[model samples]
Target: MKKYYWTFIFLYAAFSTNAQVKYADSLLTAGYTQVAAVEYERVLFETQDPEVRNEAILKKAFCYKLLGQYNEAYQNLLRANLFDENDSINDRLRYESVLTAFMASKYNDSYNQYVQFKYYSKDTALVDQAKVIAVLALNEQQKWGLASELVSELNESYSLKLDTAELFAVSKRPKIRNLKKQQLATTFFPGYVLVREGQVTSGLLSFTLKSGIVFSTFYHIIDKLYFTALLSGGMYNVFYAGSTEHAIESIKVNNQKKITRFNEKVSNSLFKALETSNFLLF
Candidate 1:
């Protein structure tokens, strides 16, 4: 009778764990990822089974990843034990760990994880996918030579090589701006720097504002309206000075934006290469 009671408890525990996992999976399928994550956590808390805990951790990490909490996702993947025991789960764990690390912009970590994954996993397809990620990770770190070598080994088309070359060229190109000259231009003419920076509308607006302020102040002074002139003078001092400083800063901002856009283009080119190869992990 005592043996039967122990058996009953074990059966109930197994059933309960299965039910929880199924429910979490359903929530995840329904796109209620946050709730699914919570349910997965509950499973982790109740289960001592290594396999169950690892699966729960993987699912929870996926939920976090979907929510763009990549660092958390990567950390959860780190909690997974029993590497190489189950090939399927191990591959998934390694892939997810690298992916989450990459998404979090921990490129070095992502690259290292990929190296480890590559060493163990026998799945050529998955290794190819990871190689793409590894190339990107190296690219992010400005390791152009390594990225080039890895990408070349991928045996992709010539266009990919061209795109990679373009990325390298763009990175090496000088940023478009002359800060000292822009500041000098702004000091002499409030909006000239902005106009030169191709922010024509903003430049015109700034110039019009300063022009109006100055005209109003001078007109009041000439009309012997001393108190009004004083007020206008105050506005002139504030707007003129502020506009000069702001114009230089605006040109700097625009220059930086152009640089950022260039960088984005480089990243997009790499992503496009991955897409062309059908190895885009996400």
Candidate 2:
């Protein structure tokens, strides 16, 4: 009778744990990620089975990742036992560790983790993933030369190679615009610097606005409209003083945008070359 009672308790606990896991999975599927994460934590606290605990932790990490809480996801992954003798779990944990670090903009840490994972992993697929992540991390760090070399070593497609080459070229030989020269140009002609920077629309708009203000001020002055002339002069002075600075800022922003787009293109090319869509979330 006592043995049967103990068996019943064990069975009840097992059933409860399974029910919790199923509920959490349902919540995750229903897009209640926050609730699902809490449920997973409950399962983690209640389950003694190593596999069940690991699954709960991984699912909770995924929930955090979906919520854009990469730091939380990374911390959760760190709680996983690495020497659990489960190759699949260990590989996924390492991969996610690198991924979360990268997502958090900890590029150096991501690169170092990838290096260690690559050296230790015998699995070809995991190694390939590590290589791709390492290259991406290096790119984020602005180590374009090293990233390009890794892409080459991976024997990526010709198009991807060209993309990396372009990235390297642009990174090394960027268009250097002198802010002082641009400011001087804007001082002489309100939109001259913008036009030179290929921002024709902005340049034309600036020119038209400034020209209108100046013409109105001069017209008021000539017509002896003293109050109107004073107001117009004030407007002109305000715009004239800020125009060069605005144009310089716009030029810098545009240049930075171009570099950002270049980097994105290289990153996309790298991901495409590795066919990361199968394994990667982004």
- The Cα error of candidate 1 at residue 81, in Å, is 3.9
lDDT of 2 by residue, 95-145 (tens): 778888888888898888788677766676666666777787887666778
lDDT agreement with native, every candidate? 0.74, 0.73
Stretches > 4 Å off in candidate 2: 1-23, 26-32, 44-54, 66-72, 78-85, 103-109, 156-192, 200-241, 264-282
> How far off is residue 100 in model 2, in Å?
3.5
lDDT of predicted model 1? 0.74
Clashes of 1: 0
| Candidate no. 2 TM-score | 0.59
Give the total clashing residue pairs for model 2: 0
TM-score of each candidate structure, all chains considered together: 0.58, 0.59
Clash totals in order: 0, 0
lDDT string for model 1 (26-82, tens) is: 787677989989999999899877877877887788778778799999999998884
Q: How far out, in Å, is residue 85 in model 2?
A: 4.6
- Candidate 2: 10-residue stretch with minimal lDDT: 1-10
> Which pairs of residues collide in candidate 1?
none
